[model samples]
Target chain A: MTERDFLCLTPFLIIAIAPVMIMVVVSVLRNYKVVYGFSVLSLLAAFGSIFFVLPSIPHTIEPLLILDVYSMFFLGIIIISALLVTFLSYDYIKQLEGVREEYFIIIFTSTLGASLLAVANHFVIFFLGIETLSISLYILIAFQRSKSNSIEAGIKYLILASVSSAFLLFGMALIYTAIGSMQFGDIVAALTGHDPLSLLVRSGFGMMMVGVGFKLALVPFHMWTPDVYQGAPAPVSAFIATVSKGAVMAILIRFFFIIKGFNNHYLFIVVSGISILSMFLGNILALRQKNIKRLLGYSSIANMGYLIIILLTGSNKGIQASIFYLIAYFFTTIGAFGVIALLSTNEYEAEKIEDFKGLFWKRPFIALVFTLSLLSLAGIPVTAGFIAKFYVILEGMKAGLIVLIISMIINSVIGLYYYLRIITMLFSTPSEIKLPKLSITGNITIAIVGISILVLGIYPGWLIDLIIRFVSL
Target chain B: MNVFFYIAAVVAIISTIMAISGRNAIHSLLYLILSLLAISVIFYLLSAPFIAALEVIIYAGAIMVLFIFVTMMLNIGLERETEKKWLKPCMWIVPSLLAAVLLVNLILALKNVKSIQPDEEAILPKQVGISLFSTYLLGVEIAAILLMAGVIGAYHLGSQKKKVKHRFLEIN
Candidate 1:
C-alpha cells in the first residue's frame, strides 16, 4: 500500500484503534463516565479524520477497499449516526445493572464494520464488514439479559442473519466459479461480453439479493424487522434502522451502478416488484400496530421501498435524492427512538402505544420533539420527509418510473395514518404514571436530531448542492 | 487415489448421518469429528494437502474440542424419548427425499458447467500464508477486528453476575 492509501484510510484506522484504546482504559479504570467520554471522543475523532483524508481520496487500497468522495460522505454519515447512538445509549446503558462499560466497545466495533461496508469493493470486505456489524449487534441486541425478549430477538437475528450470510457466501462462490474473480469491476467486465446473464451468475445474484433483502427488510424477507426492532433496546433499534441499513444501501448502490445491473430487464422487474410489495405490505401491516417500535419498523420498510425507486432511475439525481432521503430518515429515526429510550423507566420499556398516553400534558418539550419526529416520518409539509419524498418522486418521474412513484405516494398516505394515530395518542388524556427524568446527553442528541430535521426540511438546497458536488459514482 | 476418495466419501456420508441421528450430544459430536476427518481424507485424495491438513486441525481437532467442552459444560442429557417423538419417520423422510432431489439437481448442474483444469502443482501452505499476509492483509485485519468483537461479546454475555438495581436509584 502507498502512503496515499494510508492517508485515505485515516478514518478507518482511527475507528479501528479507538476500540483497543477504550478496552485498555476499561481494564484499568472501570468507570462508566470515562468510557462513555472516550467513546464519544473517538467517534468525533473518526468523523473529523474523514475531512483530513478528503484531499487524498479517490484512491483504492487495492483488492479490498476504495476511498473516494462517495465513501467519505457515507463514512461521515455512519460515524455521525454512531455518535448519536452512543449519546442515546448512555442513559439506556446506565439503567442496566451490570457490565455496561462493554457496550461502548461493541458500538465502536460495529461502527467500524459499518464504515468498512461503505468503501468495500470486494466480496471479502463485504462479507467481513457485514459479519462484524451483525456479530456486534447480536450482543448489543441482547445486552439487557434480564429481559427474555431481548434474548429472543438476539437469537432470532443470529440464526436468520447466519442463514442469510451463508446464502450470500454461496452466491459469491458461484459468481467466483463463473468469473474466476470476486471483484465488482471484474464481474462487470466479464458480464459486458455476454448479452444475457449466465445461469450461475443470475442465480448467484438472486441469492445475494436474498441476503441483502433480509438486511434491508424489503418484502418477503421483512418478517424479522418488527420482532427484532420491538425486542431490541430502543437505541440499538435506532442503530439498526439507520447505520446498518444505510451502510448496506451505500454498498448496494455502488455495486449496482458498477455492474449496470439495471440494464437487465429481469433484475429490474424483480427489484420493482420487491419495492412495490414492500411499500404496500409494510404500510398495510402497520395500520393497526400498537407497539411504537414495530410501527416505526414497518415505516422503515416502506421508507426503504421508496428509496429503492431511486435505484431504478439510474441517474445521479436519483442517487442524490436517495442520500438526502437517508439523511432525513436517519435524523427522524434517531430522534424518535431517542424519545422512546428516554421515556423507558427502570423496569418496563415505553414501547406500547398506551405508554405515551397524554405525554403532551406531562412533558410538552419531549412530546413536541417526538411529535416533530413523527411528523417528519409521515412527510408533513414542513418536515424533512416531505422534501425527501418530493425529491425522490421528482427523480422517479424524470426516469419514467410512474408505477413505483404511485406506490410510494399511496404508501406515504397509509404511513401518515399510523403516524397520526400515535400523534393523537400523545395528545390524549394523560396517564397517571410518572416518566423517567431525561439525561443531558440524550436530550442534546434528540435536540440536535430534531433541529436537523426541521432545518433540512426547510432549507434543503445546501445539502442538495453538497450531495451533487461530492456524491458521485 | 480415486478408490481412496470413494472410501473416504462413504465414511463421511455414514458418519454425517450418524452424527445427526445420535441422541447423546457427545456421541453426536464425536461422530461429527469422524465425519470431518473423512472429509479431510477426501481433500487429501484430491491433492489439496494444505486444506486437508487444515480441515483435520481446525474442524476436527480445535473446533470439535471447543464444541465438546461446551456440550460437556452444558450437560445436555439425552432426551431420547423426545428425540424419538420428534424425529418421526414421516418428519425426516420428506425433507430427506427433497434434499436428495436437490443433490441430484446439483449434480446435473455441475455436469453442464465446464470444469476448469486443476493446476498440476500443489498449492503449498507457504503460498497460502504469503498471499494471505501480502495481498489479503486488509482482510486479515478486518477479520481480526471481527473476532475481537465476537470475543468481547462472548465474554460480556457469558459472565455471571448479580443484577444490581439501577445505580442512580440504588443510592437514592
Candidate 2:
C-alpha cells in the first residue's frame, strides 16, 4: 500500500490501535480513569485524522475499502456517537465493580468495526465489520453479568445475530455464485447487463435483506430489539440503537444505491412493505410499553421505518435526508438513553416509566432534556426529529411514494401519543426516590446532544449544505 | 471421479442427518466429524486439496476436538435419559420434513445449472496463501480483531466470580 492508502486509513488505524494500547495500559496500570482518558483521546485523534485525509477525497484501498466523502461523513457520525456513548458510560460503568476498564477497550473495538462498515467496499470487510461490532456488543450487553437479564439479552442477541449472519453469508455466497464477483462495482456492472434480476440473485438479496433488517430492527425481524434494549445497560442500549444501526444503515444505503436495488419492482415493494409494517407495528407495540428503554426501542423501529422511505426515493436528496435523519436520531436517542443512564444507579436501573414519576418536580433540568428528546422523537416542532421527519416525507413525496408517506405520518402521530404519555408521567406527582448524582461527564454529554438537537432542528441549512457539497453516490 | 464424488456426497448427507438427529451429544459430534471428513474428501476430489486439508485439520481435527472436550467437560450426556424422553418423534419430525423439503428444492435448483468439470490441475497451497495475504489481507486483519474480541468477551463472561448473589446487589 502507498502512503496515500495509509493516509485514507488513518481513522480506522487509530481506532484499531486504541484498543490494543488500552489493553497494554490495563495489563500494566489497571486504572479506569486513565483508560477512559486514553479512549477519549484516541477517538478525538481519530476524528481529527479525518481532516488530514480531507484533501484526498475519494480513495479506494483495493477490493476491501473505499475512503470517500460519504464514508467520512458516516465515520464522523459513528466516531462522535461512540465518543458520546463512552462519555455516558463513564459514570454508569464506573459504578459497576471490577473489570470496568475493559469497557473502554470494547468500545474502541466496536467503534473501529462501525468505522470499517462506513468504508467497506467488499463483502468480506462488510461481514467482518458486522461480526466485530456484534461480538463486542454481545460482551457489552452482558458486561453486567451479575444480572441474568443482561446475560439473557447477550445470549439472545448472539443466537439471533449468528442466525442472521448465516443468512447473510449464504446470500453472499449465492450472489457470488450468480454474478461471479463480490465487489459492489463489479456486481452492479454485471447486473446492468442483465435487465432483470434472476431467481438466485433475487433470493440472495432477499436473504441479505433479512440480515440488514435484523440490524435495523425492521418489522418481523424486530423481536430482539425491545428485549435487548431493556436488558442492556442504558448507555450500551444507546450504542446499539444509534452507532450500530447507523453503521449498518450507512452500508445498506451504499450497497442498495450501487446495486440499484430500489429500481426493481419486487425489491422496492418488499422494502416498502417492511418499512410500513415497521412503522405501524413499532408504534403500536410501543404504545403499551411501560419500560422506557423498550418504548424507545419500538420507537427506533418506527424511526428506522421512516428512515428507509428515503431509500425508496432513489435520489441524492433522499440520501441526504437519510443522513440528516440519522444525525437527528443519534442525538435524540443518546439524549433519551443518557437520561436513563444518569438516573440509574448500580443498585437499580431506572427504566420503568414509574421510575421517572414527577421527575420534572425533582430534577427539572434532566426532565427538560428528556422532554426535548421525546418531543424530537415524536416529530414535534422545534426539535431535530421534526425537521428530519419532514425532510424524509418531502423526499418521499418528491419520489411519489404516497403510501409510505401516509404510513409514516400516521405512525408519527401514534408515536406522539406514547412519547406524550412519558412526558406526562415525568410531570406528574412526585415519587419518593433519591436520584443518582449527575456526573460532569454525563451532564456535558447530555448538554452537547441537547444543543445539537435544537441547532439541527432550527438551523439545519449548514449541515445540509455540507452534506450536499461532499456526499455523492 | 464422478462416482467418487457422488459417494462422498451421499456419505456427507447421511452423516449430517445423523449428526442432527442423534440423541447423545458425543454421538452427534462423531457423526458431524464423519460428515466433515466426507466433505473434505469431496473437496479433495474437486482438486482443491489445500482447502480440503485445511477443512480436515482446522474444522474436523481441531474444532471438533474442542467441541468434544467441552461436551465431555459439561457432562451433558448424564442427562441423556431425560433428553431422550423429551425428544419425542413429534419434536424431530416437523423440522426433518421441512429440511427435506428445502433439500429437494435446492437439488432442483442445482439441476437447472450446467455443471462445470473441475480442472485436472490442483490449486497449490502457495498460491492460495499469496492471494489470501495479498488481496484479502485486510479481511485477515479484521478477522484477527474479531477473534481477539471474541476471546476477550468469552474469557470475561466465562470467568466465575466468588460473589454469586443478585447482580444488582453485587454492584457497588
Candidate 3:
C-alpha cells in the first residue's frame, strides 16, 4: 500500500489489468487477432518488467505476497508458458466455433492466477490464487462444450475440485486453530517452538496434501487427470500440465519447506508412499492407453512421482532438479500438445491413436517433432527428459532415497515401451486423414519449444548453472 | 427472544429435513424457503439484522425462487407418479442423527462463550461497507473479477446460436 510497494508489484498488476483491458476492448470491437496479440504482448511485458524491477525485488508485499529470486524464477516460467499457450490458442480457438475472443480473457486470467501462486505468502492468498486458477480452468476445460466429454470433464473437475477446496479450507481451519496464524512464516514460528508432529498439525497437513495432490494428479486423487486432459482443448491441457502444475510445485516447495513438514516421520512416510505408488500406478495404467492425451496425463503423474523423489532430499540441489525437470517437462508438453492442436480439425481433435497413424508420411516435420517430445518423455538418451530425470535421481540418491530411484528407473524403462509404441504408430503406413495446416503462431510455438528441448538436453549445464547462481545468491 | 429463537431453530431443522426428503420438487423448494426464513428469524433474534435480511433476500427470496423456477421449467419426476411416495420415518434416521450430533457439539462448544443478547446493537451496513472497501480492498477487487468471470462464463455457455424456438423449427 506504499508507493514503493506499488512499484515492486508492477509485474503482477500488469498481468491483472491485461485481461480486463482485453475484456473492454473485445466488448467494443471484437477481433481474435488483436486479442491474441494483446494477450501475448501483455504476458511478455510482465515478463520483461520482472527483470527491469529485479534490483528492487526481494520485495515483501507484507502478509499476502513476496517477490524474490525464487518467485521471480517461477514467474518467468509461468509467463513463458502462458506466452506459448496464447500462441497455440491462436490456432486452437480458431478451430472452435463462437466467442473466440473470450479465450484470451480466460487465458490471461489463468496466467494471473498462476503468477499469484508463484508469489503467495499467506494461506488466504494461496486459496484465492488456487480458486482463481481452478474456476477459470472449469470454463476453459469445458471450453469445447459442444463435445459431450468436455462438459462431463468440466462438471467432474468442478465438483471434485470444490470438494478438495473444502478439505483444504477445513485443514486451514485446523492449522489456524492449532497455531493461531495463517501466514507461512508464523505457522513455522509456532511449530518450531513446539512438537511439530502433533496430531492437529499432521491431520491439517494430511488434508492439505489431499488438496494439493488432487491438483498435481498424484495417485488415488489422480483419476480425474486422464479424463480432464483428454476432454479439454489441447492448448488448455498444455496449460494445465505446465503452468498450473508448475505453480503448485512452487507452492509445495514453499509451504513444505517453511513448515519443515518433511521432517515429521509420518509425513515423510506418507509422501514417499504416494510418490512410489504414483510411479508404479501412472506407468502401468498408461501402458494400455490408446489416447495420446490420456497417455501423457498418466506419464505426467509418474513424472510428478519422480519430481517428488528429488524434493524428498530437501536440499538446494533437489529444488534445482525439480525446477529443471519442470522446465524440460513444460517445453516438451507444450510442443507435443501444440502439434496436436495444429492437427485438430473443426470436427475432432487428433486425439485417437488412429488419428496419428502414419503421421510421419503425411507431415514429416510434425512427426519428427512428436518423436523428439515422446523420446524426451521416455527419458531416452540425448533428450531433456533424460537429463532432467538424471538430476532428480541423483538428488534422490544424495538423500539415500535409493528405493525411489530404483522404482523411477524401472518406471522409465516401462515408459520407453509405450513411448516407442507411439513412435512406431507414427511411422506406420499413412492413413487417409489429411493433416491441417499450422498457423504461423502455432508453428513458432512448436519450433521454439522443440529447439529449447534439444538445446536444454544437449547443454543443460548452462541453465543449471544459471539456476544455481540465482538460487544460491 | 431466546424462546422465539429456539422455536425458529426447531422449525428450521424440521423444514430442512422436509426440504431434502420431500418427494415433490416444488414441495422441496417451498420447504427450503421455509427453512431459510426460519434461519433468518433466528439471525434477527441474535441481533444481526443485516445478516438476517440477507438470509431472507439472498437465500430465501432470490436463490430459493431461482430453484423453484428451475424445478418448474424442468418438471422432472412428474411422469413417475408411482414414485411419489411420502417421506417415511426410516428415511429420517441418518440425517436426524447427524443433525443431533452436530447440535450437541455446537451446544458444548458454545457452553464456554457468552450468549448474544437481543438488546445488542446490530452491525451497521455502513460500517460493513467501509471495512470491506478499506481493510479488505483486495477481496473486493478479486470478488469483482470473479463476478466478471462468472458473467463471461454464463454468456459463453448460455447464449445459443439459435436465439428462439419457433413452431416450425421445434423438434418432435
Candidate 4:
C-alpha cells in the first residue's frame, strides 16, 4: 500500500492501535487511572484525526472500505461517545473490586469495530466489523461474571446474535448466487434490471433486513433487547444503545441509499409497517416498565423506528435528518446513562426507578442533566431530541407518509408519560439511601453532553448543513 | 462419478443429522467433521477446488480439532452421559425436514441442467488465489486475527481458577 492508503486509514488504525497500547501501558504501571487517562487521550486523538484528514474528501481505502464525510461524521459520534463512556467507566469500574483494566480495552475495541462498520462498503467488511463489535460486546455485557443477570444477558445476546449472523450469511449467499457479487454497487447494478418481485432476490433482501432488524431492535425481533440492556452494566448499555445502533444505522442508510431499494413499494411498505409497530409498541411497553434501563431500552427501539422513517423516505433530506437524529440521540442517551453510571456505587446498581426518586433533592446538577435528557427523549422543545423529531417528521411528511407521521406523533405523546414519570420521580423527596459522589471526570463528561444537547437543539443549522453536504455525496 | 456424488450427498445428510441429534458431544463433533468433509467434496464438484481445500483445512481440521480438545478438557465423560435430556427426537425433526426439502429442490432444479460451456482461461485455483491476495487480502488477514483471538480466548478461559476437589479418608 502507498502512503495515501496509509494516510486514508490512519483514523481507523489509530482507534485499533490505541486499545492495545493502553493494554501494554496498563500492564506495566498497573494503574487504572492512568489507563483511563490514556484511553481518553487516544479517543481525543482519534477525534482530532478526523479533522486533520478532512481535506481528503470521499477517499476509498480499498474496495472494502470508504473514508468520507459520511463516515467521519459518525466516527465523530463514536469517538465522543467512547470518550464519555471511558470517563464514566473511570468511576463505574472503581466501585467494583477485582476488575482488570481489560474493560477499557474491550470498550475501545468495540468502538473501533463500530467505526469500521460506519465505513464498510463490502459484505465481508460489514460482517467482520459487526462480529468484532458483537463479540466484544458479549464479553463486555458479562464482564461482571459473578452477576448472574450479566451472564444471562451475555448468553442470550450470543445465541440470538449467532442466529442473526446465520440469517445474514444465508442472505449473502443467496444474493451472491443471484447477482454474482457481494459489493453494494454490484448488487445495485444487478437489482436495476431485475423485477423486484423475484422470489430469490426478495427472500435474500428480506433475510438481510431481518438480520439488520435484529440489531436495530425493531418489533418481533426486539425480545432480547430489554433483557440484555437491563442486565448489562449501565455505561455499556448506553454504549450499546447509542454507538452500536448509530453505526448500524449509518451502514443501513448507506446500503439502502446505494442500492436504491426505497423505490420498491413492497420493501417500503414493510419497513413502514415495522416503523409504525415499533413506535407504538415500544412506547406502550415502556410505559409499564418499572426499571429505568429497560424503559430506555424500549424507548430506543421506538427511536430507531422513528429513525427508520427517514430511510423509508429514500431522499437526501431523509438521510440528512437521520444522521442528525442519530447524533442528537447519541448525546442525550449517553448523558442519561452517564448519570446512572455515576450513581452506581459498591453494592448496588442505580437501575430501579425508585433509586432515582428524589435525585433532584440529593444531586441537583445530575438530576437536571437527567431531566433534560428524558425531556429530549420525550421530544420536548429546547433540546436536541425535539429538533431531531421535527426533522424526521418533516421528512416523513415530505414523503407523504401521513399515517406514519401520525403514528410517530401519537407515540411521542404516549412516550411523554414515562419520561415525565422519571422526571417526577427524580424530584420526589430524597430517600434515606445515600447516593455516591460523582467523580470530576464523570461530572465533566455529563456537562459536555448536556451542553451539546442544548447547543445542538438551538443552533442545529451547522450540523444539519454538514449532514446535507455529506449525504449529497 | 455420479454415484460418488450421490454417496457423498447421503453421507453428508446423515452425518449432519447425527451431529445435531447425537447425545455425546464428542460424537456430535465427529459427525460434524464428517459432514464438513462431505461438503468439501461437494464444493470440489462445483468447480471450487480452492474453497474445498480451505473447507477441509479450516473447518474439518483446525476447528473440529479445537472443539474436540475443548470437550475433552471439560471432562464430559461417561459419568455425565446420564444427564442427557430426552430432546433428541425433537431436535432431529426440523433439520431432517429442511434437508429433505433442500434435497428434493436440488434434484428438481438439476433435472434440466445445461451443458457446461468450458472457458479455456478458467483456472479455479489461480483465480481464487489471485482474488484472495488482491481483493480479499483484508479478509485473509482478519481471519488470521480471528484464529489468534480464539487461541487467546481459549488460554484466558483455561487459566482461570479451577475448583479444588476435597480428599476422602485414606482407605489403606
Candidate 5:
C-alpha cells in the first residue's frame, strides 16, 4: 500500500483504537468519567481525521474499503452520534446495576463497526462490520442484566439479528458464486452491463434486502424493534435507532446508487412497497402507545419509511436529501432519547407516557427540550424534521411519486398526534412525582443536539447548499 | 470413492437430524460431534487437509465440548416428567418440513452449478497465507475486531456482579 492509502485510512485506525484505549484507561483508572472522556476524545479525533482526506478522496483500498465524501460524511455523523450517546448515557449507566465501565468499550467498538459500514467495499468486511456492531450491541443492550427486560431484549436482538445475518451471508455466498466477485464495484459492473445476477443473483439480492430491512426496522421485519426499544436502556435504544440504522442506510444507498436506472426494477418496486407498508403500519400502530420508548420505536419505523423513499427516487437530489435528513434525524432522535435518559434512574426506566406527566411544571427546561425534539420528529414547522421531510417531498415530487408523497404526508400527520399527546402530557398539571435532576454531561448533550436541530431547521439552506456541493453524487 | 462419499454424506445428514431431534441435550451433543467427524472426513476426501484438520479440531473438539459443558451447567436435559410434553408429534413436523425444503433446494442449486473438483496437488499452506494476508487483509483485520468484540461481550456478560449494600444498612 502507498503512503496515500495509509493516510486515507487514518480515520478508521483512530476509531478502531478507541476500544483498546478505553480498556487501558479502565485498567489504570476505574472512574467512568475518565473512561467516558477518553472515549469522546477518541471519537472526536476520528471525526477530525475525516477532514485530512476529504479534499483528495475517492481513494479506494482495493477490494475492502473506499474513502470518499459520502463515507466521510456518514463517518462524521456516526462519530458525533456516538459522542452524543456517550455523554447522554453517562448518568444512566452510572446508576446501572452491573459493571458500568466496560459499556463504553462496547459503544466504541460498535462505533468502529458503524464507521466500517460507512465505507465497506467488500461483502466479507460488510458482514464482519455488521456482526461487530451487532455483537457489541447485544452486550450493551443487556448490560443491565438485573432487569429481565434488558436481558430479553439482548436475547431477542441476538436471535433475530443472527438469523438475519445468516440470510445476508447466504445471499452473499450466492452472489459470490453467481457473479464470481465479492466486491461491490464488480457486482455493479455486472449489473450495469445487461442482465445482472441471474435468478440466483435475483434471489440473493432479495435475501440481502431482508437482512438490511431487519436492521433498518422496516415493516414485516419490524417485530423486534419495539420490544428491543422498550426493553433496553434509553441511550442504548438511541444508539440502535440512530447509529445502527443510519450506517445500514448509508451502505444501502451506496449499493443501490450503482444499480440504478430501470435495471433495479424489481428492487425499486419491492422497496417502495415496503416503504409504503412501513409508513402506514408504523404510524397506525403507534397511535395508542403509552410507552415513550415504544412510541419512538414505531415512529422510527415510519421515519425509516420516509428516509427510504428518497433512495427510490434514483437521483442526486435523492441522495442529498437522504443525507440531510439522516443528519437531522440523528440530532432530533438523540435529543429526544437523551431527555428520557436524564429523567430515568436505576429504580425505574420512566418508559410509560404517564411518567412524563406534569414535566413542564416540574422541570420546565427539560420539558421544553423534549417538546422541541418531538415537534421535529412529528415534522412540525421550524424543525429540522420539517425541512428534511420537505426535501424528501420535493424529491418524491421530482420523481413523480405522487402516491408515496401523499402517503408520507398522511403518515407524518398521523405521527403528529402521538408526539403531541406526549407534549400535552408534558404540559399537564403538576403531578406528585419528582422529575430527576439533569447531570451536566446530560445537559451538555441535550444542548448540543437541541441547538443543532434548531439551527439546521431554521437555516437549512446552509446545510442543503453544503450537501449539494459535497455529497459526492 | 463414490460409495464412500455417499456413505459419509448420509451419515453426516442423519446425525445432524438426530442431534437436533434428540430429547436429551447430552445425547444431542454426542450426535453433533459424530456429525462433525463425518463432515471432516468429507473435507479430507475433498483433499483440503488443512480445512479437514481445522474442522476436526475446532468443530469436533472445541465447539462440541463447549456446548456439552454449557448444557451441563444449565442443567437442561434428562427430565423425565417433561418427556411427554417434549415428545409431542407436533414438535417434529415443522422442523422436518423446513429441513426437507432446505435439502431439496440445496440439491437443485447444486445441480444447477458446476462444482469444482479438488486439485491433484493440494493448495500449499504458504500460498493460502500469502493470498489471505495480501489480498484479504481487510477481512483479517475485521475478523480480529469481531473476535475482540466477542471477547468483550462474553467478559461483560459472564462476569459476576457485586451486590451493593442498602442505604438503611449503611445508616445502621
Candidate 6:
C-alpha cells in the first residue's frame, strides 16, 4: 500500500478512532453529560472529515476500499444524519438510566461501521462493516432491556439478520466459485465475458440481492421492519431508517454500477416487482396504521421502492438521482423521527397517532417542523421529497420504465393521505394532558433539517449538479 | 486425500447436527467447537491455513469458550426440556436436505474442475500475510477492535454484580 492509499482511507480511520477514543475517555471520566458532549463533538469532527477529502476525487484505498465522490457524498449524508440523531439522542436518552453513556458508544461505533460500508470495495470489508452495523443495531434496539417489545425486536432482528448473512455468505461462496475473486472490479471484469444468466453467478447475485433487500427493507424481505422500528428507541429507529439504509444503498449502487451492462433481466424484473409491491403495499397499509413508528416504517419501505426506481434505470443520471433522493430522504426521515424522539418520555414512547393530536397548539414550531417533514415525505411541492421524486421519475423516463414511474406517482399520491393525516392531527383540539416541551438541541436539529429540505426543494439544481458531477467523475 | 476430505466432511456434518440438536447447552457448545474444528480442517484442505488457524484460535477456542462461560453463568442447567414439536423434525430434515444438495452440487461442480495449473509465485501464506499486513491492514486492525469490543461487551454484561458492589461501596 502507498501513502496515497492511506491518505484516501483517512476518513474511515478518523471515524474508527473517534468512538474508541470516546469509549476510553468515558472509562476514566464516567460522566453522562461529558460523554454525550464528547460523542457529539466526535461525530461533528467525523462529519467535517468528509468535506476535507471531498475535493480530491476518485482515490482508491487499494484492494479493500475506495474514497471517491460517491463515498464522500454518502459519508456526508451519514455523518449529517449521525450528528442530527446524536443531538436528538441527548434529550431522548437522558430519561433512561445506566445506559446513556453506552448509547453514545454504540451510536458512534455503528456510524463508523456505516461509513465503512460507504467506502467498501471488497466483500470482506462489506461483510465486516454490515455486521458491525447490525450487531450494534441489535443492542441499540434492545437497549431498553426492561421493555419486552424492545427485546423481542432485538431477537427478531438478530434471527432475520443472521439468516440474511448466511444467504450473503453462501452467495459470496458461489460468486467466488464462478469468478474466483471477491473484488468488485474483478467481478465486473469476469462478468463482462461470462453470460449473466450463468446459474452459479445468477443465483449468487440473487441471494446477495436478497440480503441487501432485507437490510434496505424492500418488500418480501421487509417483514421485520415495522416491528423493529416500533420496538426500538425512536432515535435508533431514525438512525436505522436513514443512515444505515443510506450507507447500504450507497454500496449497492456502487456494486450495481460496475456490473451495469450485465443484462440480468430476471433480476431487474424481480427488483421492479418488489418495488411495485413495496410502493403500493407500503402506502396502503400505512393508511390503517395507528402507531406512528410503524406508519413511518411502512412509508420507509415505500421510499425504498422509490429509490430503487433509479437503480432500475442503470444510467449515471439514475445514480445521481438516487444519491440526491437519499440525501433528501435522510433529512426528512431523521428530522421526523427526531420530533418523535423529543415527544417521548420515560414511561410513554408517544407512538400512537392519538398522542400527537393538537400538537400544533402546544408547540407550533415543532408542529410546523413536523408538518414540513411530513409534507416532504408526502412529495408535496416545495419540499425535498418533490425534487427527489421528480429526479427519480425523470431518470426512470430516461430508462423507459414508464410503468414503474407511474407506480411511483400512484404510490406517492396514496402515501400523501397518511402523511397528511398526521398533519391534520397536529391541528386537532389540544388534549387535556400536558405536552412535552422541545429541547433547544431538538429544535435546532429540526430547524436545520427543515431548512435544508425547503432549500433543496426550491433549488435542487446545485445538489443535482453536484451529484451528477460526482457520479460521472 | 479425497478420502480424508470425505471423512472430515462427514464429521463436520455430524458435529453440526449435534451442536444444534443437543439439549444441554454445554453439550451443544462442545459439539459446536468440534464442528468449528472440522471446518478449520476443511479450510486447511482448501489451502487457507491462516484462516484455518484463525478459525481454531479465535472461533473454536476463544468465542466458544466465551459462549460456554455465558451459558454457565446464565445457569441454564439440565432442566425440564420443553418439547419443540417442529425442532426435532427440522433438525433431521434441514441438515440432510442442505447436505444432500451441497454434496450433489459439489460433485457436479468438481466434474468440470480443470486440472490444477499452479502459479509458481502462488505462495498462499506469504501472499495472504503480505496482502493482509499491507493492503488489508485496516481490516485486520478493525477485526482486532471488533474482538476487543466483544470482549469488553462480554465483561460489561457479565460483571453486573461486581459493578453493583463497586457502586454500593462508592455510595457508602
Candidate number that wins on lDDT, 1 or 6? 1
Q: Who is ahead in DockQ, 2 or 4? A: 2
Model 2, A313-378: lDDT tens per residue? 888999999999999999999999999999999999999999999999998988899999999999
Comparing candidate 2 with candidate 6, which one achieves the higher lDDT? Answer: 2
Candidate RMSDs in Å, in order, are 5.7, 5.3, 4.7, 5.0, 5.3, 5.5
> Mind giving the per-residue lDDT tens digits that candidate 6 earns over B1-172?
3554676678788889988888967667766777787777667556566787889899989999999778766754533342353246654564455445445534543453332213222237788888888878878977765665555444443343325555557865
Better by TM-score, candidate 4 or 2: 2
Candidate 3 chain B: 10-residue stretch with minimal lDDT? B105-114
lDDT of 4 at A389: 98
Docking class of 3: acceptable
For residues A158-212, write the lDDT of model 6, one tens digit per residue.
Answer: 8999999889888988999988998998998888856545899889988998889
Q: Candidate 2, which CAPRI tier?
A: medium
Could you list the chain B TM-scores for each candidate? 0.63, 0.67, 0.64, 0.54, 0.66, 0.54
List TM-score per model, in order: 0.90, 0.92, 0.88, 0.89, 0.90, 0.88
Positional deviation of residue B126's Cα in model 4 after best superposition, in angstroms: 5.7
Question: What value of lDDT does candidate 2 attain over all alpha carbons?
Answer: 0.89
The list of candidate 4 runs beyond 4 A from truth reads B1-14, B69-129, B141-172
**Least accurate stretch of 10 residues (summed lDDT) in model 2 chain B?**
B109-118
Q: Itemize residue pairs with steric clashes in candidate 3.
A: none
Instruction: Report candidate 1's interface RMSD in Å.
Output: 0.7
List residue ranges in candidate 1 displaced over 4 A: B1-31, B38-47, B72-119, B162-172
iRMSD of prediction 5: 1.2
Report the first chain's TM-score for all candidates.
Answer: 0.99, 0.99, 0.98, 0.98, 0.98, 0.97
Q: Candidate 5's residue-wise lDDT over A123-198, tens digit each?
A: 9778988998999989988888788998999999999999999999999988888888989989878767565448
Q: For candidate 5, what's the RMSD? A: 5.3
lDDT of 4 by residue, A1-473 (tens): 56777777777778778766875686578788788778888888889988888887678856887877878888888888878887888888876656457777778778877888888888998888777778777877877666789889988998998899888888888888888888877888878866555778788888988888998899878999999998888889998998889888889899988877788887888899889989999999999999999999999999999999887787888888888898899999998999988998757888999999899988999999999999999999999999999999999999998999999999999999999999999999888888977788889989998999999889999988777866653
- Top candidate on lDDT is 2
Rank ordering of all candidates by DockQ, starting from the highest: 1, 2, 5, 3, 6, 4
